[model samples]
Target: MSDIPQERRVLTAIPGPKSVELQARRTAAVAAGVGSTLPVFTARAGGGIIEDVDGNRLIDFGSGIAVTSVGASAEAVVRRASAQLADFTHTCFMVTPYEGYVEVCERLAELTPGDHAKKSALFNSGAEAVENAVKIARAYTKRTAVVVFDHGYHGRTNLTMALTAKNMPYKQGFGPFAPEVYRVPVAYGYRWPTGPENAGAEASAQAIDEITKQIGAENVAAIIIEPVLGEGGFIEPAKGFLPAIARFAKDNGIVFVADEIQSGFCRTGQWFACEDEGIVPDLITTAKGIAGGLPLSAVTGRAEIMDAAHSGGLGGTYGGNPVACAGALGAIETMRELDLNARARRIEEVMKGRLEEMRAKLPNGAVIGDVRGRGAMIAIELVKPGTKDPDAAATAALAKACHAEGLLVLTCGTYGNVLRFLPPLVIGEDLLNEGLDILERAFATL
Candidate 1:
C-alpha cells in the first residue's frame, strides 16, 4: 500500500452517478434536518485522500473532524482492531471488566501530563468526558458554577450547550441552558476589543477579575478552556494568559480543566497543548483522535479530584469499550513508534511555509487575517481587509471552490470565518503541498 501511487484523479464530476443516487436515497431515508460539508460521497480512504463514490480522489484535511490522527485506514490501527474483534466484540466493561480497559487507563495515567498520581475514566464521546469532568469538579469543590470562555465549544448536550458559546447552530432553539454556567471573554487576539498588539495578559486578567467579581471565585467549580480553541477558530491563547488563569484557579480552589479534545495526541506538536505553557490542569478531557476513530473519551486528573466521585457514579455501560481500548493502545504505540509528534511539527513547517507565502503575495489576502495554531492543528482566519470584521462569506466561497477542485477542507469560528486544517499527521509532503496548492488557487479566486 505504501508503494501505491498517490494521485488525485477525478474520473467523474463530484456528485457523479453513484453519489447522486445515494444523495437522492439519503434525502428520502435520512433526516431532512441533516447537514453536510460536501455533496461528494466517500467510498474509500487511505493515507491522505478520500475516494468519493464517483471515484474522484481528493486530499483530506479534515480527518473526520480530527479523530484520525494516524490517518484513515492506518495499518497498525486496522491490524490491532481486527485482532481485537477476532477475540471478542463486547462484554460491556461495567458488566464484565477487562484487562484492555485497565491497560488503556494505565497508559492514560502515564501519558497525560502530570507526574502526580492520576486516575482516568473513559466515555463514548468528548461531551461525556466533559460532563463527567463537571460532575467530578462539582463533587470535589462542592460548588455549583462552571465558567467557560467565549467561543469555547464543549459539546451539544444540555449542560455543555450552556458551556458552549456559539448561538446560531449549536444553541439556537435549544435554549434554557443549564444553570450556574458563566461566560467570559477568550484571549482572541484578532478581534479582542482591547487591541491585538498588546500582551493578552491584561485582557485575560480582566476576564478573570470580572468572573471572580460576578460569581465569586469560591463559588466556581471549574473553569474549562481549550488550550488552542477548536471550533473557536483554532486560536491559541496568548502567552502568560493560560498560566495566569491556571494560577488563579489554583489559588481560588477552582478545578482547572483543559479540554484537549481537538488538540491532544501530538496534534499540537506537544502531546498536550497545556504542556506548551507547563501548566498542569486539575483535569484534562480528551477524545477525537484518542482511539484512532473509535468512540472513546477520557477524563484524567489528580487522583484526589477524580476520587471525589463515587465509584458507582463514574462507570458507563459502554464507557471503555474493549475494542476502543485496544485501538487506543495501538494508536498510542503507533504514535510512539512512528514519532507522530515530530511528524506534526514537520507538517506545520510545510503548511506554515505555504500559508506565509500566500499571506505575502495576495492583496485581497487580508482575508487571511491570522495564521496561527501549534503543530498540525492549524487555521487561517478570514476577515475584511484592515478590520476585525469576519469575512464569513469569503470563507464559504473559498471552501466551496476548494471542494469543487477536489480538496476537502473545514471551516470553523465563532463567526464561521476561519479555515481549520486537521490533516492526519501521516500525510505525505507531496499530498500536503498539493492540498496547499488547491487552497492557494481557491484564495486566488476569492
Candidate 2:
C-alpha cells in the first residue's frame, strides 16, 4: 500500500498500447451503441487519479459520474464489502430478507432530510428509484397526472424518459412515453426567456401559475425536480424557486419529490441540496454514490406515502442484495466518520475561487458563458461570447486537450456545451490543483 505512486505519470499517449488494443477488441465484441467519455480503459483508481490500462495515470475530475464520492477504492468500504462477501452474497430482501437491508433503510430514514416518519425501498439504479417514486406517489394520491420541469432528467426508462425533457439521445425514437406526465418551464437563469437578472421568485411564480392553469393542481399527483439540475448544465434554480415550488406543492396536496440521485450524499455541501433552503420534500430519490460503486438505489419518503403501495406492489429480484446493503452501510459509515459534507464545502471553496479567477482573466476569449453549482457538483456552461448560443466546438476541444494532458473531465447539458466537475471529495489538494491547472491552460488555449 505504501508503494503506490501519489502523482500522475503519463508513460504513453492516452490510448497507449494496451488501451488501443482493448478498444479494438471492445468495438468488435461489445455493443457499438455504448459510448465512452475517454478511450483509455482504467486499470485502477484511488484518491483522485485513474491509472489506465496503458500505465498512464490521469487526474480524475469525473468520479465515475459522481459514483465514488468517498474516493475510488476507500479502505473501509473495501474491508466491509469483502467481509460481507464472505458471509453472504444474495437473499433477495423480499423473499428471505436480511438485517443489512433493514439497517440500510434505517440509516436512510435517519439521514434523508425531514423529521417525519420515513420508510425506504431499495432498487438497482437511479432510474428505478425514480420510477418507484412515481408509483408510490400515484398510489398515495390515487391520481394519474405527474408533473416534471423542463431540462429535468429522470432516467432512461420508458416512464422516466417521458419525464425527461431531452430528445435525440434520451427520448427520441423511444416514445411514445408514459401518459399523464406534464412538463413546465424550469427556472434556468442563463437561457430563461426573462434572463438571469430577473429574481428567481418571479420566475418560479410564473412557472407555477402556468402549470396550474394548464393541468389544474387538483389533477397532479407529484412535482419532481432535481435540487441542482444535473444534465441540465448544473443550473441552480433562482433563490426563491425551490421554496416557492415546495409551498405550492404543499398547498395543492401535490407530492413534492426531490430527485437527489446526483446531488445527494454530500455531493452538494449539505447532506442533500434541498436542505440549503430548509425544504423537506415528501419523497427523495437517490442512487449513484449511495453504495460506493455497488449498484443500489432507494426511494425514501413519508411513512404514509411509502406505505400506500400494497404489500408486494414494490421491489425487484435484486433490489436489496445483501452485498449491496453491506456496501451501503460501509459507505454511510465512511461518510459520517470522514465528515465528507465538510470536505464537499472545502472542494467548493477551492473550485469557486479558481473558477472565478478564470472568469475574470478571460472575460472575452474564454468560452465559459457561466459557472454555477454548489459544493463539489460544479459546472461551467460554454457559449459564444455576446450570445446564448452553445459553443459545443470549443467545449469539445477543451475536454480533448485536458484528456491528452492526463486529466479526465466530462461534458453535459441539453446542448452538450457545459463541462461538469465531480471530483471525489477525498482527492488531495495537490492533485485537485494539478487538474485545475490543466483545465485553465486548456481554456487559455481555446
Candidate 3:
C-alpha cells in the first residue's frame, strides 16, 4: 500500500556519505541526551524496510521501538489523519470537545479486557497515561504508596523513573524522584534466583509479603506491572505470577494497574498481555501501537475508579488532540480488518521456532541464555555461555553486526544483555525471513 518498495537494498555503506554529513549537523543541533540505535537518518519507511539518507534500505526489526505495528505508512491511518488535519488540528479537548475523543474512549472500553463498565482518558504519551492512572488510583483509595516490580520500566519522567528499576541509562544521575513508590520482585523466569519452575509461586509470594510487611497494603493506592516487561528484556512474568498479584491487589482493595504500553495493541498476540492469564486489571495504561505511530496514550479502567478524578483534575493541553484521535480510530479499523492479533501469533510461531533452532545449533562456547516473549515481541538474553551471568558486550556486538548488514535491531534489559526484535506486523513474510536470515548470519559469525 506504500509507495516505497518493500525489499531491502544497500547501495552504500550503512552510514554513507550523506548520512555522515547529517550526523554531524545532528550532533551540533540536537541535545546530547537524545540517543539513537541506528542513526543513518531515515528518508522513508514502509512495510519492513527503512530507506536511509545513504540510499541503503535497512530491514526494520525495531519498528520504532514497537510503535508502528500497523506499518508506519498505513493507508487508513494516513487518510484519516490527513482528513482530520484538513478540518482542524488544535482546539484542545477541554476547550472544544470533539466526537473523535469520545469515540476513541468508547472503542477502548470495548477492546480492553473485562466486560464490566469501563471509562478512559487520553494522554500524549505512555508516561502521562501511567501518571494519570496512579493519580486516579490514589484519589479513589485515598492512599499514597504505589508498588512496582523489579526490572520494570515505566517511563523517563520523575515519578516513572522512580517506578523503574534499572539504573545505568534510565536513572543514573537523574534522581530526587517522587517518593512513596516501592519496588518488589518480578517473576523473571530465566534469572530467578531459586529456579525457573519455582519462579511463579515464590516470586509472587515474596512480592506480596514485602508489600504487606513493608508498605502495608492498606496504605497502597495501586500495584502496577507490565504483564510482559518491555525495556526490562521483554521479560514475561512467569506463569501464575500475574494472576497471583492481581488476586492480591483485589483482596486488599488496591488498584491493580497493568502497564500495557509496550505490550498492548496486539503486540503480544492479544489486545493486552494481561489477557494471556485472564487477569483483568482495575486500570490499564496503553500507548506505542495505539495510533499507527501517532502519539496517543490512554488510561482505561473501571468506570467507578476512573470517575474518581475530579473533572478538572485530569487533562493536558494536548491530550487526545482531534487529529491523534482520528489516527487512533483508523488504527483500530486497520487492526480489525487485518486481524493483526493473528498476524502477531503467526510471527511468534515463525520467529520463536527459528530462534529455538538457532539456539540448538550454537557452538560449544556460544552464549544465548534464554529465548522468550510472545507474538511480535521476542528477545534473546545473552549470558556467559555456561553461567547465567549477563554478557552485555555480546549483546552489543550482535546488534552492531546486524546493523552493519543493514538489519536494524535493538538491545534492551536492566543489565543490557537482551537482543530484542519488533518487526512491523504488516511486514511481508519474505522480508521477515530475510531479516531473520541476516540475524542468523550475524549469530553464526559471533
- The top-ranked prediction according to TM-score is 3
| Counted clashes in each candidate structure | 0, 0, 0
Which of the numbered candidates is closest to the native, going by highest lDDT? Answer: 3
lDDT of 3: 0.93
lDDT of model 1, residue 115: 96
For each candidate in turn, the TM-score is 0.97, 0.98, 0.99
In model 2, how many backbone clashes occur?
A: 0
Tens digits of lDDT, candidate 1, 273-344: 999999899999999989888999999999999999987999788899888888898889888989999999
The runs of at least 3 residues in candidate 1 whose Cα sits more than 4 Å from the true structure, single-residue gaps closed, are 1-5, 197-199
lDDT of 2 at 35: 83
> What are the per-residue Cα lDDT tens digits for candidate 3 across 1-446?
47888888888888889998999999999998999887799888888888888889989999999999998888999999999999999899999899999999999999999999999999999999999999999999999999999999999999999998999788999999999999999999998988889999999999999999999999999999999999999999999899999999999999999999999999999888999999989999999999988999999999999999997999999999899999999989999999999999999999998888888886833588899999999999999888989999989998999999889999999999999999999888888888889888888888
Give the least accurate 10-residue stretch of model 3, judged by summed lDDT.
357-366
Q: Model 3 off-target regions past 4 Å?
A: none
Q: What is candidate 1's TM-score against the reference?
A: 0.97
Task: Name the 10 consecutive residues with the lowest summed lDDT in model 1.
Answer: 1-10
